[model samples]
Target: MTTPELGLPMAVPAQGLPAAVRIYEVGARDGLQNEKGTVPTEVKAEFIHRLADAGLTTIEATSFVHPKWVPQLADAEQLFPRVSELPVALPVLVPNERGLDRALALGARQVAVFASATESFAKANLNRTLDESLAMFEPVVNRAKTEGRHVRGYISMSFGDPWEGAVPIPQVVRVCRALLDMGCDELSLGDTIGVATAGHVRALLSALNEAGVPTHTLGVHFHDTYGQALANTLAALQHGITTVDASAGGLGGCPYAKSATGNLATEDLVWMLRGLGIDTGVDLDRLITTSVWMAEQLGRPSPSRTVRALSHKE
Candidate 1:
């Protein structure tokens, strides 16, 4: 095939694209956690089941946070146990030891912890400074490993922040190293506000590589706030990153950062991967259908370009 025009997206080089990619589906957890309306326990369970049926291998289940903090995911206790039987990794987000304890009691086999790259975001998001937040997660990560569960570390605001703009690569790497050293099996760098460009993505990955962080143990989490998630993802893929985090129907935003918006849609990522010839194990058509059904449940159409395109013909 030839390019319609040698442009930015089509201009993407194939030299570094991975043979396959692993998508970390965050619809059930990250996507809906910030929603204003309460999603029924049954609906959340059904959503995870449908995502698995659509061939998502790793679906973030829910968070074990205090209901007073996040009412939308307050049903984590009831939600996780029901979807625990799904034949995939149902990792829940654990904020501290208490959250971890709750997750362990619910038979969680895998878990994730989040940290921030900037001090301002850390204080706003975790109410702790950078070191304090990492210190808090150390025990959680260590204990989760002791419980024989896998742990994923997330570094939010890796690329940029609403309060502090243009985050330095070294600042992001320090937290990244701490997370990995704390026994996190994998670390995902999140572009929380979606201010990253392709150049920024490549530069950050390069810095991580130079800092001795294995690319194989890293993932990329990009938001579509500026419509740059896929482009950043392509840059990451070319840099040898295989794990990509996405949400079904592009259904997520940072509750803390009002400027931040929904996540990169699963269908859009699948569509790009299909064109790149990288296998994601996701059925795009089925994923689109799932997202469309979910949008109906939310009383709105999906924000995913591919989902909207496929679900409704012009």
Candidate 2:
């Protein structure tokens, strides 16, 4: 695969690895939102800039939820305009039609709406039942599509919910189907609490496949709370799931689930992908550098093992 040490769309072989995998960088929005203190709008835009400069083609920028809901990302309006000129897709999380309205006004080209397979998480995060949350997102997804924008759906707690020990495969599939039926271009199934193992990963994908959802239309968002994010990611890759959601420097967790830790670190995922001869088009050293700089802003060391090992080697 030929990739500039810094640019994207690297050529990759179709042999054991995926021809190419899209690393959906969710650090700026997801990572920052979970932080204790709010980041300055300038810092957030610069963070997104550095990430895109490192060759992340798609970065989840900011959420359009109310400031009361996510105070860390309260400057969505200010942050979006600053990073609008970047050459990457910036997909923001829109909780409902009102949030979508906010995103539209800012010229958002892509948006994502989230649902939960477990009623416990649904109630906790969306303050609605599982069915009600999906119904709520129906119009939001439809409206985004009508506006010629790319719409993605998310099903949180697909593997396990904090209150619900294990999520049923049927329940997960039902939500996935509903999102796809609602005109979502793709559905990202999240292991929100990160209790997923390789076996569980296979089981969920198998169930989704049997339910007639093609693998191409699916993405996997795995958290590393239990230290199984990479293993679950390998399992998902083996199942032909090419899109993986990760946070830069392992920087995010679900605010509603205090037990949840950071998402799989982008540095870690790229390290594994490169070793497998899979193309991710990310500059590993640059990603580590960016994470290190971001860690400075957060006043802590990064949680990524790859970053830790590589930093010492340097």
Candidate 3:
């Protein structure tokens, strides 16, 4: 029997898309945060190293939230120093002033603050009102900026929320604007529940632009719960968004939102981007190997479709 060929897709250049895309890899942090069993700190460090070796320039290393909130990432201090020598950008998620201070003390140059658009999510996830959460972030963002760190603000539920269905574009825009105004270098709009369609993605981008947020400063973080992540990403690309947040092997869901599912898989996003003739600078085979290894460590098969298909061929 003849062996089947495992090859890359034919490059079909898509118009109106950027020549290159910056994939903000989040597997180490967001991916492992929701795991039922704790992933060992050494293994998590190795995962980040493997991702950087696969050519992902921006990798979120870990979160500095309190151990009570996310016990999985309680080893942020230990993990950060282990992978700090990597040449890529290692952005850690900082929930507030305390988290930011922990990251800064460890020489982290890039940090991200996670925020919510709706009042319900703000209260549930942050134990504060939407405005109060923003107020809390104000000091964190300002301090990070004062220390010369590049801050990224992630606005969750930009599309829809389980408790608050169908988030208004204006509502999302307000949060985005607030973050940008607070000195965030970029904003990642997250569809936490994966309920956004292509049109919704475009409409929200348009609204942010109309509100004076530049397309260059926006990134899209879509969940594949309803299988709309890739579609929504294409819409964002068409609107001139160049930064995208994807998790390796499709790992991670919002711990606060039960309905939120895994993030858009890095491998899947790379496959589509490669087919579109867009550059992501990732070694697909290497990334697949990393995800497969991570899945082995977790004792489960990877949820990424591209990882499954390509790894099978290997």
Cα lDDT computed for each candidate against the true fold: 0.90, 0.90, 0.94
Q: List the residue pairs that clash in candidate 1.
A: none
Model 3 alpha-carbon drift over 4 Å, by segment: 1-6
Tens-digit lDDT string for candidate 2 (1-314): 55634323344544545768999999998888988877889889889999999999999999999999899988999999999989999999999999999999999999999889899998998889989988999999899999999999988989998898998889899999888988999999899989999999999999989988999999999999889999999889989999999999999998999889999999989977876778788888889889999998888999898888877632
The candidate, 2 or 3, that scores higher on lDDT is 3
Q: Single out the weakest 10-residue window by summed lDDT for candidate 2.
A: 4-13
lDDT of 3 by residue, 159-253 (tens): 89899799988999999999999899999999999999999899999989999999999999999999999999999999999999999999999
Cα RMSD, model 1: 3.3
Cα error, candidate 3, residue 252 (Å): 0.5
* Cα distance off (Å), candidate 1, residue 289: 0.9
Top model by TM-score, which number? 3
TM-score for all predictions?
0.95, 0.94, 0.97
For model 1, the stretches where C-alpha displacement exceeds 4 angstroms are 1-13
Q: Which scores better on TM-score, 1 or 3?
A: 3
Q: What's the C-alpha lDDT at position 12 in model 3?
A: 82
